[model samples]
Target chain A: MSGKYKDVAYYPGCALEGTGHAYNRSTKEVGKALGLKITELKNWNCCGAMEVKNVDPKLQTYLSARNLSIAEEMGYKTVMAPCNGCYHNLKKAEYDLAHDQNSREVTDRLSRKAGHKTYEAGKVETIHALDWIKEEIGEEGLKARVKNSLNGLKIANYYGCMYTRPRHIFPEKDQGPGSESTSKPHFMDDLLAAAGAENVDYPLKTACCGGAHTLSDSDTSTKLVLNLLTTAEACGADVIATECPTCHTGLEMHQARAEKVFGRKTKVKILYFTQLLGMALGLSARKVGVQENFSDSMDLLRERGLY
Target chain B: MPIHEKSLIRPENLVTHEHLEIEGVDVSGHWSTFINTRAVSDYNEQMQEEIAALPGGEYIHRCWQCGSCTNACTVNAINPDFNPRYWIYLIRMGYESELLRDKDIIWQCVSCNKCTYACPRDVFPEGVMKATAHWLELKGHTEKKPSMVFDETFSEQVFATGKIEDGRVLREFFARTKQSLFQDWLIAMVRSLLMRLPVTLMMKLGLATVFHPRTRGWSKAQAAIDEYVHEREAAARKALRLDVQGAE
Candidate 1:
């Protein structure tokens, strides 16, 4: 294995175990197909996932810090999370621990009480799956490895909130060349383009799916997801390439909700970028867990000869 | 504090008389508008400080009234009444009554962070919205919002098990919110999934529901989190001047 992200610590968080099972399966399958290694974080807990912060931001920090601490304990400097919520929380915890003394003290106190070593900032670096694929194997590497190209598929790469927001949390992004942009992310686009798919110009690429209130405020989530779906369809995207599980499920759920409740039916398919990349890498739909997804793209896949 | 004059153009504050002559000039229709005047005195002096005391609302004091937050807000795009800039202005000026006008929609911020991203003052307006929502609920201005209920439900599971099963959380949230499990769209979504799902994978998922996934040796962490949550809740209640029972 390459000494880089070929073998990094993986933190799937809670979503992957349930609704985001497709993402979990596709991410692993793509990693395996590309000859990368993923060492799952040993007994990793939730990374707070946008809900704990409402109760207490410091507690959310502690929750993510515990996961980072485990990676540190396991001797891996880089811990990778595929879920935007997990990735954002880990990065936010790292930032808060370094900059805010209160957060540090609270995390330390909680760690001591929990009988585990406190996670110090700078002990480990948090990266998203986008960075894992982009940095480890560039577009050139990806292009060379594509066995079954996505010849006619059109994609709208959607990078939801939490991946890049509040700006300060993601310090590494927005740097000059070779770094991801917070305002207009293109890593997913770049990766998909290399796999022989056409990417449409989607304005709402960084729009919120209202994943935070998917269940809490169903109507609001439906509206937000409806806008994303219709906008993607308008952009001539056959599929919305997603990097976050919450976003994937949010779109899928709300698409149905919009049709059933709001009477606003949209035809844009939603699939994880890994699932798309996995298919481009010659893996079957079932192999990448497409059936596990709430949004069925089987007919589309078969029509495009991808299934 | 300077008296806040009711705007002459405001529909609620304006009074119009039809078919009446003003000074015998026959200014009877459009020119007959007059604003109702009132002295502004009832202000919650501790409103800003109380909101600032909440976790996400800490940096609200840094705001300079730039409309960037509202302009870039996600909810604002849909509902014109959901204005963050106006709400922040009200909070900072201790215009409690004015803020209450939109108390119900404050919790609908969606945490999009567009406000945070657009704010040049680093006010973290997204956090301020959450804090304001919490403040509204604590002050008895509004009930616990569905979003807060969802957050508590999701957090409780995480604190208890060090993990959460989305299906269980969804079921519990729907139950708490008095929503039916068999919504048409939800059933349609499930039907689509079930059609393509393999039997073995379905079996595995069923077994997962039976034996919920949990982190091993998570008891100590769970205990620590529960204690921290309890202390945090008490502290938050204290900040909002609520009793231990969350009553003011």
Candidate 2:
């Protein structure tokens, strides 16, 4: 593993501070356990998630660019975002600023008016939590650090939509063997497998949980998330490990919605990959914020003697 | 030219003779089913251009009738009526009336980007979906959808303050949509979380609701974004020709 990402800027975004607090907690805990350094982006604003783009895509671009400019000012070459929405938006802003003249113009104008340094494309590279872990601490490194290996845990790693969709934004992925594949992402799976978990062949790995409209259009989000949960169960997965906070929350919210509204009960647990990895590295469930998850995996973790 | 697909044709336009001979050829029942021909004269000549003028719809002219967007569509997979390819075809053809038939469901697009990923022509069907939804509301073809209401609520917070508290966004969205926040599933979700969440964490989340998180020195950025949004909104209204009508 390269030492380039040992210490990098972190952008937790809005979700991390709110509904995805567990993800934030576990991510930081896992980093600490792995001996990796993390420096949070100071006074960062929202990355617009999936909402701002609906109002106007350029506004969304400028919003993310603001965060990238902060990273540049902080002197970090690499910025790691734990939330897929934040990660995708930053990557998209980078792509648009570099490729589209109009995007660059609008962003520069907004930056000038907003009284911040305009974020030029290629100034700072943005990476997802999966890439941060997979690249920084390779699977071999994870295997060596596992104190309580996830030996018997059956996991279905759910990459969700934003991580690898509209593949154009992510130029680094899909480059032959060692690089991540956009169509069939395996960074989370690779990391978990190294932690001794059995990775299932979950087909809906990159499927949309309808996270964008999770609250607005509840029924569709419910159906989409139900499909993910049921498929994970069908694949014999005890837990659906997620890297995106939106997908994680969507899966958990819609799991309950499906049972109440559709009367279709599913038993698969939803856990952040960081939480799972944190536990494998000997962090207690409490330390990884496992209890903060909406899905109660205490019984399963207890039965598997994970803690 | 109107599409002649069996599913695209309205049932009312399908004519069939139960037991009759056409020109003495014994054409009856299923064999005699004929699609009633109707002249389409209400085409909104500017429909395609209007949609293209909106953000994300810029590449609408590049589509070549490919079904890849529809094939890879996440919404279309669940509900066959949510077809991006068909919608693009209608918009390009200026088939305004036909497009209106599916106006309500268009906003239900999850913005999943599967269509964008699969579109061979770089039409960015996902963006086209968002643009069409906006166009529908701007033209008053449909009421503000729940998704649009959610977007406005979420964006307003971002524009006002550089950050948003999730609890506030959720509460405001439900209130604007006239939904009771005490839904069974939502209550169950919160209850499950409260069962194990530490008191400190709960206090932190509760405090965030009272004191909404804001980016320090964000007023300048907020003002800039507001100006840009107003400009975009006015441009969209003009493109849809709604400005001339004095309708919102």
Candidate 3:
């Protein structure tokens, strides 16, 4: 709108505020480089996620609306969420407030608790931070930051189901519309493309990597992980990449289970968006928070001759 | 090098929210309280929901059921038998056993929030979906949700050294899980009998191992972590500057 978001509105949600801080960290860095400013939403709270909105869809709508409405009143029109979950919740609130009168009424009631603030649903544009970065930075801009590129990379663009699905919040086209969909218009894919990655056709791009299920149902989660690795292996992908911390955990942490299932040694690795981004930018592993991973990305890089 | 020929098949239903009823999955009642409330008194109530869910989720009230969650869900996208939308809906009703029983599907939420993104209602279904997994784990449900397994070790690692010692965390996690990675297995087996620890202990416990690495100045790191966490908490409070009329 202003050429670039000189002052971008940021919502880290609760998880990103805490353990999932790395996403926020990477996003801020990348956004800043692209001339998009990242400003923390004042008095922002959790989206009541990790709880079932299906239990009380109204409450989910209400709380999420209240947060966004607050942002609207603060004069912020663009809501940037690093967490796909947050992005969905915030965007959904906006959409609900727009179409459902009941939701608006309830949101108004919730606004009472805001100590005297009101929210209008459509007052903001909610998008994953990645979407805007690609728009602003473009391939040329990203190429400028390239001190290094992923050469000879057998990189897999593991969308992990979040990047392209739930097309309501994201542009419908981003989902690569139609049943015969192959490569999604996934921003992560674009990001990988910018990094000079050769995207392997990963079937589990939208497949569940066994999120919290890994904790509640290890055997099941293990199977899910097993499937993911097997799928990536089938695609001949040397490494997998993603944007969410939870997704990262599911794919990497479940490696042991995968090994147990196949009864063979496994060597696949999982990484955060920044880890791969850093590699593509010719940055060192530590700069992209590589040491924090369970499986080393270096080994994969070396094996692929990308290092 | 493999050539990844881009498919002409369009990705039409990516997390497309279609109303679904996963038969055989049992749970009666709808989770409408979180959404119907209209308004919360303040931010803490909202955060309370997130923290309580912890390792699982913070976006409990975000689902508007476009089937985007189910559609985008890795498990569902791959295996419709495991639907996140249905699992989360069950959670909305506080259907504990229903969620616990699937044990596998409940843990299968994959934390991507594609459903959350597409709901058109911003109902981060993934948060509560994950939280349900945590709730299952807290209740001593043996089902190991992918992210929840890290919860205990992540917390313990934090408490033990004020910072995460990845090596220790990983080793501790495997030990607790009963999976012995070579040497770590032998140590866990020996420790298992030596401690006379009950089987319930093994419920969260696993085979022991020294596979995880530890830091040299863990005590300093621990203190720093505690101090930082406290400071962050204090800062949050300072930011809220709460105007409480009644401290019930």
Better of 2 and 3 by lDDT: 2
| TM-score of each model, paired residue for residue | 0.95, 0.95, 0.57
For DockQ, candidate 1 versus 3, the one ahead is 1
lDDT of 3 by residue, B98-147 (tens): 44547755655555556666556666666566555545544456655434
Compare candidates 2 and 3 on DockQ and give the better one. 2
Q: Report the Cα RMSD per candidate.
A: 2.6, 2.7, 16.5
The Cα local distance difference test for each model comes to 0.90, 0.92, 0.56
The runs of at least 3 residues in candidate 2 whose Cα sits more than 4 Å from the true structure, single-residue gaps closed, are B1-9, B14-35, B244-248
Worst 10 residues of 3 chain B by lDDT: B32-41
Candidate 3: segments with Cα more than 4 A from true spot: A1-6, A171-183, A260-265, A301-307, B1-248
Q: Given candidate 2, what's the lDDT at residue B109? A: 91
Which lDDT tens digits does candidate 3 get at residues A43-160?
A: 5555645333422344556556656765677788777777766676776676677787866765665455434456775578776766666655666777778767876466676655
TM-score of chain A in every predicted structure: 0.98, 0.99, 0.86
Weakest 10 consecutive residues of candidate 2 chain B by summed lDDT: B1-10
Show where candidate 1 strays beyond 4 Å. Answer: B5-34, B245-248
Evaluate model 1: give its lDDT: 0.90
Candidates in order, interface RMSD in Å:
1.0, 0.8, 12.5
